[model samples]
Target: MTGAVRLEPVDERNLEPLLSVAAAEAEPEDVMPPVDAPAGWSLARRDAFREFHRASFGGLAGPTRTAMYAVVSGGEVVGMVRMTRCDEPGVVETGMWLGRSARGRGLGAAALRELLHAAAAAGMHTVVADTTPDNAGALSVLRRCGAELREENGKIRARMCLDSAIPIR
Candidate 1:
């Protein structure tokens, strides 16, 4: 079982652990390309990712935004999730990953449930996610997280309509 998870605003404190997970979870077929993979999350890649995070955070932010968060459980950041605005005015897209040590538990679902609620409370009515076809784990996470799924242009698109009264998990 996984412990209770907390969502913390990404900052200098939790950035390293989050990036470390991002590196460890990297795969060649990943949509985000796992940053500096093979070589692992190298220093340069880490810096660039951080810079991108800062820029994305600073750009057109609202209560609902590409809000970067560290998924904390048992006093550590086991994963990270980001919610960004989509072309649809009230829709947001989410992306997330867990470290190897954090996989196979119910943590991802619980944490994502929280993330969905956060986005809903922030005025986002829907959340979307896309995953590679071969990413079974991600597909499962989408189903378990209460997102509606579809295949489009070779990727699985997960869409979840959020309501303040909706109960996830």
Candidate 2:
């Protein structure tokens, strides 16, 4: 694929597109009960998901340890990615979604690689991601990015060591 997409830091003007992609990517099955949800999972709660991106991208309220970015293609936003809770010092968690229209084009993996690069650049030593077992697409992306998988708490968690200099490509 051509390198036509660019990942830019999230800002107020691009929050809506990010939210749209998130909502489109999310499925009823993807919704886990809030208590059992993974950390940084406010997006799984009732209606909290709608405005969750705003806290980080709209500058409303959220941990300063988080950084969000929008994946723009042909001048339009088609996906979103985030690296959060870096205050843990060497660790960070990633979350991302490609809009319905952008799926099946290898953009998901590309976006993930970009997010991992961002995390590594920020001095993170490890990056983690989790998805329901049914989400084969997501799991594939994680595996393609060289993440090690483990089954935990009914979810598939993937972790990658960013301290190494392995290129995501």
Candidate 3:
């Protein structure tokens, strides 16, 4: 049960859809900043999404850059993934979120794997990710991707080498 996974660059044409998905999937305990809509969605949530989208898209600029992409599966915008900024030069840290309708379908792992492929193709030597200990879904994805795990500052950190396979934790 696999769907075609593709990466679409975040641009003006796809920006609204991305924001809508973010608003729909907002979770209170999400590791990343939430871009949720307000209860009535008249003011606060709209403003928050605007700021988040602006900052996020702005980060796409320049030579030393971070890449953010919309993860599309079966032609629907399911989520977003990115290589976040890291102090290490050759390592890219990744994170993603699936919309409510897209959860529990194994899409998260698919998206992460695609991100890993992209990172490796871009000359990244290693990839890293982190999630809370209790996030079984995320932990499962990391484990399935064969990421090496360690606990740091009370969070579970996962690292993988693009040049070789790792023992899943």
Pick the TM-score winner: 1
lDDT per residue for candidate 2 within 69-113, as digits (tens), equals 888877878877777874566788887777677777777777887
TM-score of each: 0.83, 0.75, 0.81
Cα displacement (angstroms), candidate 3, residue 113, comes to 0.8
> Could you say which candidate leads in lDDT?
1
Report clash pairs, candidate 1: 66-83
lDDT-superior candidate, 1 or 3:
1
Candidate 1 structure lDDT? 0.74
In candidate 3, which residue ranges exceed 4 Å CA deviation? 1-3, 28-42, 58-64, 165-169
lDDT of 2: 0.71
Model 2 segments more than 4 A misplaced: 2-4, 19-51, 58-64, 167-169
Better model by lDDT: candidate 1 vs candidate 2: 1
